[model samples]
Target chain A: MNPTYFLLLIYIIVCTLIITYWAAKHSGTTKQYYIASGTLTGYQNGMAISGDFISAASFLGVVGMIALRGYDGFLYSIGFLVSYNVVLFLVSEPVHRLGKFSLGDVVCSRFPGQKMRLIMAICTFIISLLYMIPQLVASGFLLRLLLDLNYSVSVLLIGTIMTIYVVVGGMIATSWVQIIKTVLLMSGTFLLTLIVLSNFNWDLTLFLNKVEEGTPLGEQFFLPGHLFNIPIEFLSLQLSLVLGTAGLPHILMRLFTVRNTYEVRKSLISATWIIGLFYFMTLILGFGTVALLGYEALIAKDPTGNLAAPLLAKVVGGDFLLAFVSAVAFTTIVAVVSGLAISATIAFSHDIFFHILKKGKTTEREQVRSARITAFIIGLLSTLFALRLESINVTSLVSMTFTVAASSVFPVLVLTIYWKRFTSVGAITAIVSGILASFIFVVLGPYVMNPSDGLFKTEAIFSLYNPGIVTIPIGFLGGILGSLLSKRIKQKETDFNSFYIKAQSGYSSRGES
Target chain B: MEEKLLNYIYRKRKRLFIILIFALLFYFFLPLSLIFIPEIMNKPSFLFNLPWAWVYAILQFPMTWLFCSIYHRKAKKDEQELDAIKGEDVN
Candidate 1:
C-alpha cells in the first residue's frame, strides 16, 4: 500500500468529518439544513457553486478526453463554461426570489398546488440521481486503481461517507466541503500547470510542437472530427451542455444560499470567473499530458483517459505529486456527491414529504428527520446503481444527464418565468414529455444499445448519442401545446401579473395593473 | 406612476433579451464555424502561429468573463434604478 496516498486520503476525510460535526450543531432548523439559512457571502457561495459544479468528470475525465481526443475534447469544457451565461441571464435572480429551499418552491411559486410540487420533486430526484451516479462511478474507478479495492466496495465506501455528511450535517456541511474542495482543486491544478510550463522552459511554440508530435493525429490534432464523425452529434452535444447548467437541480438550489439579487449577480460573476479560469488551466494541463507523457503512454495506462492528469503528475513530479492530484480528485468526487445527495434529500423531504404528503404541517424537527432519512435512501440507491456502471466511461453518462436536464427542467423553468401564457398543465406536460423523450432516446441510442460494448447486442435505434436537438424542441412544444389546449377551457387564470412583477423586481405592489 | 414602472420593466426585459440573443449568437459561432467553414478555421494565423479555430475557442474564455462582468455591472445599476423609481412613487 502507498503510504502517502493513504495519508492524504485520510487527511481529507478527517477534515470533512470535522466540518460535518460543526455543521450539525447549526443545522437544527429546516432552513439551516436545506440552505444554511442563506448566510453565505457572494464570493463564498460562488466558490461553493464552482465546487458543486466541477466533479471528477471535469477534473479527471475532461483532461484525459482532451489529451486523447485533442480539440474535440476541449469543446466539452467550453460547453460547460458557456452554460453559466444561460443561468445568469435567464434564471438566477428569479430563482433566488422565488425558491426558498428547492426547485419545487420556484415552480410552485407560480402554479401553487400539490400536483406542481410532486412534478418538480420527481424531476429533481431523477436529475440529482442521474448526476450523482457519475460521481460515484468515477470514484469507484479511482479507488480501485489506487488502493486495489473492489469497485463495488469503493462505491459503497464513498456512498456511506456522502450519506453521513448530508444526513448529519445537511447543506451547511455540503457547502463547506464543496468550498474547501474548490480551494484544493484550483491550487492543485494551478500548481500542476506551473510544473508543466516549467518543464518546457515556459516556451509556447516548442510546447505546441511537442503536443502535435506526441499524438498520433499529428497536425490534425488541432482540428475537430476526432471524437465525433457526424456534425449533428457535435452540435447536439454542444446544445445540451450549453443549456444544461441552467436546468441542473443542484445548481439551481445553490441560488437560495445567498441573500439578495445583488449577491446573486456576484455569485454568478464569481462562479463564471473561477469556472472560466479552471477550464483554461485544464486546457494547458491537457496539452501538457500529451507533450510530456505522449498519447500512447496515456492510452496504455488508461484507455478511457481518466488517469491522464494523475499520470502526467507522476511523470513530472514523481509519486508525491501523483498522490496529491489523486487525493484532490477523490475530494472532488466526495464534494459533488454530497451536494447532489443534499439536493435530492431536500427534494424528497421538503417537496414531497412536507408539501404533498404532510400538507406543510410538519414540525421542523420532523422535517429534518425526514430529510436525513431521505439522504440515506438516496445514497444507498445511487451506490447500487453505480456498482453496475463500473465498466462505463465517466464522461458518457455526463452528457445524458445534461440532455435530460436541458430537455426537461430548462424549458419548464423558462416558460414559467418568462412566458406569461404558460399554465400548470403546460408545465406538467413539458416535464413528463421531456423526461420520457430523453430517457427513451438514451436507451435506444448507441450509448446503451451498441453492438460491441453496449448493454445490448443490437444496433442503436436512435443514432445520435446526444439527442438534444430533437428532445429539447419536443419539450418546448409540449409545454406550448398543452398551454394552448388548456386555454380554450377558460380555466381559472393564475395571477401572472403579480407573479411576473415579483419575479422581475422582487416586489409585488397592488397598484401595478 | 404604475404605468411608468411597467414601461421600465418592459424596457429592461427587451434589453436583456437583446443581450441574450447576441451572447447566444456569439457562443454558437464556434461549433458552426467548425462545421461550415473548416478551411478558414484551420488556417494558421499570425499570433502564436496557431490555427484560427484554436484562437476562436480560446477567446470564448475572455468572452464569458466579459459578458458576465458587463451583466453584473448593468444588473446592479438596474436594481438601484428600480429602487429609485419605487422611492419616487412613494414620495
Candidate 2:
C-alpha cells in the first residue's frame, strides 16, 4: 500500500475508534441501542439519515453511471431525490409517531400480533442483507483498486469494522459515523465539482462541449436510451427508486430516532436539501470525469466506471487527492454497512427474539446483548456472501434491492397508514406476494437469464430488468384483495382509528388505553 | 364536534394527497412522455449545446426540490391549523 493509503486507513480507524468509544456508554440500554434514546436533534438526525441514504451506490456507482451513460445516470439521481417526497409527504410522520425501534414496530403497532412482527422481522432481515451485499462488494472492489488488497481480505475488513461499530456502539455510534461520513462526502464532492468547473473556466456549456468531444456518442451522450434501451425498463427503474426509498428498513428505522412527528418532518426536509444538493454536485463530478479523463480512460480504469470519481481525483489533484477520495468512499461503505447491520440486528433481537420468542418480557440488558450477537452473525454471513458474489455489478444489485423493497414493504406500509380497512390479512398477504412476485420476476428477468453469463444459460423470458412496475401493482392488489375478501374485524378498525389519530395529530399514544 | 374535527382532518388529508399525486405525475410526466415522442429527445431545448433529454433530466432536480419545499410549507401550515382547531375544542 502507498504511504498515503496507509495514512488514510489509519485516520479512518482512529475516527472509528473514537466514535465507538464515545458512544459505547450511551448504548448500554435497549432504547439507546435501537433509537439512540430519541435524543438526536433534527439536524443531526437529518445528516445521519442523508448519510445513510447516500451510500456507496450513490457516491461511486451512480457517478460511475453518469460518467459512462451521461444523462441516464443523472436520471437515477433524480429518481432518488424525488423519492424523499414519498417519505416527507406520506411515510415519515406516521413512522416516527407510531414506531418504537424498527419498521416492524410501526407495522406491528397497528396489527398487534407476533405473526406480523415475525413477518416484518423476516422482511427487514432479507432487505437489509440484500442492501449490505452490494455495499460490501463495492467496498471490496474499491479496496482492491485503491490498496491492491485481496478482494476477500477487503470484504472481511469491512465486515469486521461494521460489526464492531454496531456491536459496540449500536445506533448512537452508527448515527455519529454517518453524520461524519455525510459531511466528508458532501465536502469532497463539492470541492471536486468546483475543481472540475474551474478547469473549464466555470462554463457549463463549454464543459458539456468538451465532454461531448471526449466521447464517441458526442451529442447522443445527452440522450436517455443508451443505458436503459427499453421504455418499460427505464420506467420500472424510476418507479423502484421513487417508491423503494420509503420502504427501506434502515431508512424507516431512522425516523424512530427522532423525538416526534414534527422533528421527523424537519429531519426529512433537511435530509432532502443535503441529499439533493449532493446529487446535483454528482452531475458535475460525473460529467467532469468525462471531460477531464474521458469515457474511454474511465472505462479502461474500471469497466463498470466505479472508479470515475477517484480516478478523476487522480487526474485533477494527483495521489494525495486520490487517497482522500478513496478513503471517503471506504467510509461511505462502512457507514452504510453499519447502518444495515444495526437494522437487521434490531429486527432479529427486538422484533423476533424479544417480541416473538421471549414475548417482549426480556430485560433491556438481554435485548441489547442479543442485538450485539445478532449483528456479529449477520456481519459474518453478508461478508461470506460478498466474497462469493464478487463479480456482479454493484449498482444493478443495489437496484434489485430497491425493486424488492418497492414491491413488498412500500405497499403494506402505505395501506397500513392510509386505509382504515387494512387488516392483518392484507398486510401479511402484501408482504408475502410482494416478495414472491419480485423474486420470480427477477429470476426470469435479463439479469439472471441472459444467454451468455446468466445462471440458467437461456433467453430471458421476462423482458423488463426491474420488477417494480409489475410487482408494485401486484403488492397493492394483494393488500386490497385480501382486505376486501376478509371478514371485517371490528378490533382492527378501532386500532386503525387510534393509530390514525396519533399519526395525523403528532400526539403521543402512550397514555391511551 | 369530534365528527367535525374528523371531517376537517379528512379534507386536509385529501388536499395533501391530491398535491402529492399531482407532483408525482408531473415529475414522472417528462420521462414517460419522452417515450411517446422519441423525436423530441434529439432537439436542444434550453442551451443550444444540450439536448432536450439532458435538459429534462437536469431540470428534474430543481423541480423536485421546488415541490418538496412547497409541500413542506403546506403540510406545516395544515398541522398548525389542525392543532389550533383541537385547542379550540379543548377550550
Candidate 3:
C-alpha cells in the first residue's frame, strides 16, 4: 500500500475514534444509549436514519447496477425511497412513542411479557446478524480494492474497528458518524455526477443514442427493450425490491429515532426527496460511465462495475478524484456499519439482557456498558461469518436482508398499528413464521451458489432470490394465526388504542397536543 | 343503506382497515391485474429512467394511499364515534 492510502485509512480511524469518545462522554443515560434519549428531531434523525439505511451496499451497489444494466438499477432507489411513505403513514408515531428501545419494546409494550420480548429479541438478533454479514463482506471487498490487500485481512480489520467504535461510543457515535457518512455519500455522488455530466456533451438524448447504437439496449441512458427492459425474471425481481424494502428492521428502527408522528411524516417526505434526487442523479452518472469510460474501459478497469462511478471520477477528474471516491466509499461502509453495530448492541443489551434479565431497572451506566460490549460481540460474530462466506455479493445480499425485514418486522409492526386484534400471541407467531419461511426459502430455494475457494468455505442458500412477496404475507398470516388462537383475543382493541396514542404521542410533551 | 357504509368508512378506522385491505387485494389481483400479473409485472417504466416494473413499484404507494385515503376520511369520522362510546360527545 502506498504511504498516502495508508495515511488516509489511519485518518478515518483516528477521526472516528475522536468522534466516538466525544459521543461517549455525553451519552451517560440508558435512554441515551437506546433512542438517543429521544432528543434528536426528525430532520436530524431523518438524515441519520438515511445515513444508517443507505449503507455501503446502497452507496456502492446501486451505482454499479445502473452502469451495468440501465434503468433497472434505479429500481432499488425507488423501492428504498418509496417505502418510507408506508412507514410515515403507517408506523412513525406508534414506534417512536411506545418503546424505550428495541422493536420488541414496541410490540410488547401493550402486551405483558418476557416470553414475547425474548422471542422477538432472538428474532431481531438472527435477522440483524444476517444483515451484518453483507456489511463485513463489503468492507473486505472495499479494502481489497483500496489497499490491494487480501479480503480476509480487510474484514478482520474493519470488524475490529467498527466493534470498538460501537462499544465505546453507544448511539451517539452511531448517529454522528451516520451524519458524517450521509454527507460523504451525498457529496461523493453529487461530485461524481457533476464530473460525469460535464463529459456527456450536455445531451442525454444524444449520449444515449450513441450507447444504444452499440449495446443490446439500442438506447443506453434509458433501459432498453420496452422503456425498461422486462427481464424474463422481472416479476421476481420486482417483488423483491418493492415488498422487501417495506419490511426491513434496521430501516424501521430509524423511524423510532425521531420525536413525533408529524416529524416522522415530514422526514418521510424529505427522505423521499433526497433519495429520489440521488437516484435521478445516478441515471446521469450511469450513462456518463458508459458514454465516457465506455464498456471496454469498464470491463478492463472495473469488471465488477463496483467501481463504475469511481472510475468515471478518475477518467474526468483524474487520480485525485479516484482517491476521493475511494475515501468516500470507505466512509460509506464505516458510517453504516457503525450504525448497524450500535443498533445490534442496543437490541441485545437493552432488549435482551437488561430489560429481560434484570427487568427495566438496569442503570444507565450499566446499560451503556452492555450496549458497547454487545456491539463488540456482534461485530466479532459478523466478521467471522463474512470471513467464512466469501463469495456472496455484498450488495445483493442486502436486498435479501431487506426482504427478511419487510417480511418479518413489517407485518407485526403494521398489523399491530392498524389491526385491533393483533395479540402478543399473534406478534410472536408472525415473527416466527416469517423468519422460518424466509429461512427455509433461503436455504432450499435454487440459487446459483458460488462457493468460496477453500479459505473456510461458506455456502449461500438462495441468491437472485427475493422472498418478500411470499414471506411478508406469511408474516401477516402468522400474526393473524397467533391472534386467532390467543384466549385473550378481545384485548386487541384496547391494546390497539393505547398503542396508537403511545405511538402518536409517545415522545411528545405531556397532555394531548 | 349503502350511504351508511360510506359514512361509516368516512368516519371509522377499524372498519376502514378492513376496507383498505380489501381494496389492496382487489388492486393487486383483479382490476390492477395488469400491475402485478406475471406479464405486466415484468415490464418497467422509463419516466426518470425507472424500469417498467418500477411503474408498479412507484405506483403502488399512491395506489395504497388512494385506497387508504378513502378509509382515512372514514377513520376520521369513526374517531367521533369513539368519543360517543366514551360519553364525552353526549354532553
Candidate 4:
C-alpha cells in the first residue's frame, strides 16, 4: 500500500537472504552451527547477545512505556540491564561450564535421568514459550500497523522465514543476524530521538513550558502521574522490572556464547553504558509521545496503551519513519523468536534427546538434525500459543515471564554457587516450587485484578511488577529443605570440593585429568 | 578450617563478584539516567540528552567481553576440578 511498507518487506527479504547465504557458507560442522563452535570473540557475541536480548518489547515496547509511564517504564530498562551483573555474578560461569550446550544441558548434567532433562526443557519451553508469545504478537501488530497486513499473514511470514534461518544456519546464523538487527535497531531509535529533540528549543524550561500549557491538567511531560500511578504502583513496578531482568532466558543463555570470565565482567560494564543511555532515550520517547498524541489519543489508539511508541513515531517522524519503526518492531520479533527457538532446540536436542535418550550415541549430524527439527516444532507451538492466548500488554507479559524465570531458575543457581551443603533434592524442589508458584501467580494471582481503574485489572496481592519478594525466598527454602530431607551424598560432596577448586582455577582442562 | 573456607569464598568468588558488578551496574543506572534526564529538564541536558538506545546498542560490545572473560575463567576452574575429582559422568 505504501513505499514504507514495501521497503520493510524488502528489508525482511534482504535479512533472510543474508542469513541463508551465511548459513550455507558456515554450515560446516554441527558444533559450529549449534554453539558457533564457541569461537566468537566476546565483542562479536556481545552485540549478538544484546540484539537477541533487547527484543521488540525492549526496543519498541519499553521506550513506549517510558513515553507513556515515565519513570515506571525506565524501571524495566534498569531491571533488565542490572541483571547482567546477576547473570555474570551467579549464573554465567556455572551455566557455561556445567553443560555442553543449553540450560537443559547444565541442569540435567547434574541430575539422575531423562526425567530431569525433560523437566528442565519443559520449564525452558514454558518460560521460553511465554517469553516468545509477545515477540510474535508484536510482529503481527507492527506489520498490521505498517503494511496494513492481516495478523496471520504477518505471523506466518515471520514463522516461515525464521524457521529457514535456523534450519539452515543454526546458532551462527542466528547470532550474526542478531548483530545486524542490533545495528539497525540502535541507528533507527537514535535518528528518531534526534529528530524529536530538534523540534524542542533544545532547552529544558521551554520544552516543559510548551508541554504544560498544551497538555491536560497535571498531564505535563516528565511530571508525575502521566503513565503510571505513583507509590504502590511505582514500587511494585520497579521490583518487577529489576527481578524480571535477572530471569529472562535469552539474556542468561548469552553467557554461554562467550570465551571467558574476564570477558563476562568487561562486557557487562560496557553493556551498562549502552543500557543506561538507552533507557534515558526511552523517557524522551514517552514525553514525545505525550506531547504529540496526548493521553486521550494514546488511550483511543490502543486501550492497553501498548501502541503509544509506534503512534508517536507517526507524530514526529512522518509516515515513512512510522513504517520504518514498525518494520524494526516486526524484525525485532523475528530475531528474538529465532534465537529462542535455537536455544530451546539446543537444550532439547543435546541435553535430552542425544544425551539421555540416545545414550550419547547420537552423531553430530543427527544432533544438528534434531536441533533443526526441535526449532521447527517450537516455532509452530509458539504460533499456536499466539493463536490461543488472549492478547496481553507486551510490558506485563515480559514481567510475568521474568518473574517466573527469576523465581524458578535464579534460586537454584545462586545457592549452588555459594552453599556447599545444597543437595540435588534442593535443586529439584526449588525448581519445581518456583515454577509452580509463579505459574499460579501469573495465571490466577490478584495482581491482574482491579480493572475498574485502568483498561485492565492488574492489582494482584503482589503488584505484577516484581514477585521476587515472595518467589525467591520460597525457592531458597525449597532447596534447603530438600537438601535436609535427602541423605547427604557424602563422597561426591567431598570430591566436589576439589571439583570446586578446579572450576575456579580457569586452566582445568589442561593438566589434572 | 572454617576460617579458610570463609576466606576462600570471600577472597575469591565474593570479592571478585562484588568488584565486577559495580562495573556492570552501569548498564541500568546510566541508560536510566539518559532517559531520566529528559524528564527532569525541559531541553534534555548536556551529554545527558544523548539518545540512549543507540549508545547501549553500541556499548554491548564491551559487556560481551566482561561476561565471557568472567565465565571462561570460572568455568575453566570448575571444569578442571570436576574432571580431576572424577565422579560418574551422569550424562
Candidate 5:
C-alpha cells in the first residue's frame, strides 16, 4: 500500500464527512432531509445529476472497453449521452412538478391510492437496490487495489460511509458529494486527456494512426461490431441505454432538488452539456489508452479493461496519477451509492412508513428517523450482498439494471404522464409485466443459462443479452391493453383535465400561481 | 377556454412527437448503417483519413445540443404563453 494513495483516500473521506456534519445541521426537517427544500440551483443540481449517473462502470469499464473492443465501446458512451434526450424532452419537468419526495409521490399524484404508492415504492426500492450492489462491488475491488485491504473490509468501509452520508446529511450532503465528485472526475479525466495528447505532440492524425497500430484489430479498430457481432444485440443494448435514464429512481429524484420547471430544464440542459463533454473526453481517453498504453499491455494487466484508465495514468504520470485516477473512481462509486441509498430510503420511509404505515399522519421527526434507519439497513444489506458477489462478473448488472428500468418504470412513467386513458390498473400492469419480462428474459438468456459458465448447467432459451428491445415494447403493450380492457368507471369531470393542465404548464388549481 | 388550451397542448405535443421521431431515427441510423452498410461507414472521411463511423459518432454531440436548444427555446416560449393565458383567466 502506497502512502500517497492512502493519504488521498483519507482526504476524500474527511472532506465528505465534514460536509455531512454541516448538512446534518441543516436537514432537521423532513423536507430539508429529502430534497434540501428544493434550494439547489440548476447548474448545481445538474452537476449532482452527473455525479449520480456516471458510476465506476463508466469511468473504468468504458475506457477499457474502448481500448480493447474498439468502436463498440464508444457506442456505450453514445447511448448514455443520448438517454438524456428521453429524460429532457419527455419526463423531467412534469416529474419535477408532480413528485415531492419519491417516485411514489409522482405516480400517486394521479392515481391517489395506497396501491399505486405501494407499487411505485416497491419498484423504486428494487431498482435502487439492484443499482447499488454493483457500485459496492466495484468499490470493494477498487479499495482492495488501492489499500490492499480485504474485499469484505473494503465493502464494509464504503457501505458505512455511504450510509452515514445519507442518514446524517440527507439530500444536501448527497448533492454536495455528487457535485464534488463531478468536478474531480471531470478535471482528472481532462488533465489525463491533455497529457495523452501532449505526449503525441497534439497531433490528431498521428494519434489515430498510432491507435490503429497499437490495437490488434488494426484498421478495423475504428469500425463497429468488434464487441457485438449481431446487429440485434447492439440495437437491444442501445434501446435500453437510450431509454433507461428517465426511469432511474436516483436520477429522477434529482429533479426535486431544484425549485421549478424552469430550473428543471436548466438542470437537464446543464447536465446534458456536462455529460456530453465527459463522454467526449472518455472517447479520447479510450483511444489514448490504446495509442499510449497499447492493447496487448492493457489486456495482460486486466482482461476486462477496467484498469485501462489507471494503467494509462501510471504509464504517463507514474504512481501519483494512478492513485489520483483510482481515488476519483472511488469517489464516483461512493457518490452514486449514496444517491441510490437515499432514493431507496425515501421509498421506504416516506412512501411506505409515512404514507402506508402511518396513513400519511406521521410526524416529521419520525419520518426523518425512519429514513435514517432505512438508509442504514439498505447500506448494510448491499455490503453483505457485495461480499458474496465478489466472484461474479458484475459488468452485466449495469445493463441489466438499465434494461429493468427501461422496461418497467419507463413505460409506467410515460403513460402516467402522457396517456389520458392510463389508469391505475394499467400502471400496475405495465410495471409488473415489464419487470417480469425482463427478469425472465435475462434469466433464460446467455447470462444465466449457458452450460459452461452460467449459474445453471443448461442451454440458453432467450438469446438476446439485453432483452430491452423485446421487453420495453411488451411493457408499453401491457399498459395499453390493460387500460383498454379494464372495466370503465364513470369518468370524473375535472380529474384528467386538472392533472393534465398542471402536468403541462405547472398550474395547479391550488392557487399558488 | 379549456378546449383551446387542450388544442394548444395537442399542437405542442405534435411538434414534440415529430422531433422525437427524427432524433431517434437519426441516432439509430449510425448503428443501422454500420450493420447494413458497413462499406460506407468504414470508408475514410475527407476530414483526416478517419472512418466515417468515428465522425458520425462525434457528430451526435452537436446534434443533441442543437435539438435540446431548439426544445428549450420553444418550451420557454410556451411557458410564457401559458402564463399569459392564466393572466387572462384570472382577469
Candidate 6:
C-alpha cells in the first residue's frame, strides 16, 4: 500500500470513528435513530442536507463528466441544483411539519391505513436500495483504486463501515458524518479551484482558450448535444433530475430533522447556496482538469471521467492533495451510503414492522433494535449486489435511482400534499404502478438492453434511457384515476382540512400531542 | 379565525404557485429554447472563447440561488403576515 494512502485512510477512519462514538449516545430512541430527535438547527441541518445531496457521484463523477463531456456535465449539475427548488417550494415545509420519521410518515398522516403505509414503505425501500447500490459501488471502486484492494473486499469494507455507523450511531451519526464530509469536500474543491486558477494566473479566459487548444473537439466542447443530442432524451433526464430529488427518501428524511417550516426554508436556502457554490467550484475544477491533465490523458486515466478530479488534484498539488481528495471522496461515499441505509431501515422498522405489521403497538426499544438489524441486512445485501455491478458506470446507476424516485414517489407525495381528494387507494395505485412502469422501462431501455452488452442482446424497445418523461405522467394519472374510481372515504375531508391547516401554517403535529 | 386563516392560506398558495411556475419556466427556458432555436446554441459571445451554451450553463448556478432566495423571502413574508393575524385574534 502507498504510505500516503495508508496514512490518509487511517486519519479518516480515526476521525469518523470518533464522531460515531460521540453520536452513539444519542441513538437510544427511535426518534433519535431516525431524525436526531428533531434537534438540528437550520445551519447544521443545511450542511447535512447539502452533504446528503452532494454525493460522491456529484463531486467526483460530475467533475469527471464535465472534464470529458464539456457543457453537458454542467447541465447535470444545474439539474441537481435547481431540483432543490422543487423540494423547497413544494415538499420541504409540508414534509417537515407532517413527517415524524420518513416519507411514509407524511403519507400515513393523511391516509392513516396499514396498506398505504406498507406501499409507501416499499416504495421508500426500493428507492433507497436503488440509490444505495450506486453509492456502495462507487465506494468499492474508490477503495479498489486508492487502496489497491480487491473490488469485493472494498465493497464489503464499505458495507461494514456503513452498517456500523447506522446501527450504532443512527441518524445523528449519519448527519454528523455527512456534515463533516461536506465541509471537507467543499474546502477540498475550493482549494483545488484556487490552485487551478493560480496555475493560469487567475485568468479564466486564458484557461478556457487553453482547454480548447489542441483538443480534438475544439470549439465543439463548449456546445450542447455532444453527449445527449436528442432533445427528448435531454428533456426526460432534466425532468427526472429536477423532480426526482424531492422524492429521494434520504433527502426527504433530512427535512424532518429541522424544527419548523421556517427552518425548512432556511435549511433549504442555505443548502442551495452551499451546493450552488460547490457546483461552481466543480466547473472550475472540471475545466482545470482538461487544461492541466489534457482530455485524452483524463480519458486514459478513467473512461467515465470519475477520476478527473482526483487526477487533477494529484497533478496540481502532488501526492498529499491526491490522498486528501481520495480520502474525502471515500468519506463522502460512506456518509451517503449510511444515509441510504438508515432511510431503508426506517422504512422497514417505522413503516412496515412497527406500523403496518404491529399496528403501531411496538415499543420504542423494539423499533430501534429492528432498525439496527435491518440496516445490517440491507448493508450486506447491497454490498453483495454492488460486487456484481462493479463494471457499470456509477453515475448512470445513480441516475436510475432518480428515475424511479421521480416516477413513483414524486407524484404521490405531490398529490398527497396538494390534492385533497387523494385517497389511500390513489396513493397505493400511484406508487405501485409508478414503480412498475419505471422499473420495466429501465430494464427495457437502452441502458440495460443495448445490442452490444445488454442482457437481452437486442435493440432496446424503450429508446429513452430515462423513463421519467413517460412514467411521471402515468403516475399522476394513476392517482387521479384511482381516486376518481374509488369509493369516498368519509373522513378524508376532515383529514385534509387538518393537514392543510398544519401544512400551510407552521403548526407542529407534535404540539397537539 | 378559521375562515381568515383559510383565506390567507388560499391567497398564499396561489402566489406560491405562480412564483414556482415562473422559476421552473425560467430554469427550463434555456434547454427548451435551445431545442426550438438550434442556431443560437452555438452562437459565440464575448465570454472568452466560450459559446452561448457555456455562459448559460455557468449562469444556472447563480440563477438557481436567486430563485430560491426569492421564494424564501416570499414564503417568510407570508408566514409573518399570518402570524400577525393570529396575534390580532389573540388580542
Highest DockQ: which candidate?
6
Ranking by TM-score: 5, 1, 6, 2, 3, 4
Q: Candidate 2, which segments miss by more than 4 Å at Cα?
A: A392-396, A488-493, A508-513
On DockQ, the stronger of 2 and 5 is 5
Per residue, candidate 4 scores C-alpha lDDT tens digits across A292-387 of 677678777775556777787888878888887777776677788888888777767777788778988967778777877888887787777765
Model 5 segments more than 4 A misplaced: A489-494
TM-scores of the first chain across all predictions?
A: 0.97, 0.97, 0.89, 0.89, 0.98, 0.96
TM-score of 5: 0.98
TM-score of chain A of 2: 0.97
Q: Lowest summed lDDT over 10 consecutive residues: which window, candidate 2 chain A? A: A504-513
**Candidate 4 local lDDT, residue A40:** 66
Q: What TM-score, computed on C-alpha atoms, does each candidate reach? A: 0.97, 0.96, 0.82, 0.82, 0.98, 0.97
Per-residue accuracy of model 2 over A447-475 as CA lDDT, tens digit each: 88988887778999998888899999999
State the displacement of the C-alpha of residue A436, model 3, in Å, after optimal TM-score superposition. 0.5
Comparing 2 and 3 on TM-score, the stronger one: 2
What lDDT does each candidate get?
Answer: 0.89, 0.85, 0.66, 0.64, 0.89, 0.85
- Please list, in the order the candidates appear, how each scores on TM-score for chain B only: 0.89, 0.82, 0.44, 0.46, 0.94, 0.85
Tens digits of per-residue lDDT for model 6 on A1-513? 779988988888788888888888888999888899888988899999988888888888889888888888888888998999899888888887778888888887888777777888888998898889878887888778766888898898888898888888999999999999889999999999999999999887889888887256787888877788889999999999899998899999998888777787888888998999999899889889988999989888778888989999999999999989988888888888888898999999898888877888988898888888988888888888898888875655677789889888999999998998887888888888788888889888887888887767899999998878998998899888888878565534335776887777755334441
Here, model 6's chain A TM-score works out at 0.96
- For residue A36, give model 1's deviation from the true position in Å: 0.6
Q: Model 1: per-residue lDDT, tens digit, A1-513? A: 589988998999999999999999999999999999999899999999999999888998789999998888898889999999899999999899888999999998888888889999999999998889988987987888866678888898899899989999999999999999999999999999999999889999889999999999998888777887688999998999999999999999999999898888888889998998899999899999999999999899899898999999999989999999988988888889999999999999999999989998989999999998889888888988898877875555777789889999999999999998898999999999898999899889998898998889899999999999989998999999999898766544458877887788886676531
The candidate with the higher DockQ, 2 or 4, is 2
- RMSD values for the candidates in order, in angstroms, are 1.7, 1.8, 5.7, 6.4, 1.4, 1.8
| Rank by lDDT (best first) | 1, 5, 2, 6, 3, 4
Instruction: For residues A102-132, write the lDDT of model 3, one tens digit per residue.
Output: 7877777666578877877877776677778
Which TM-score value belongs to model 4?
0.82
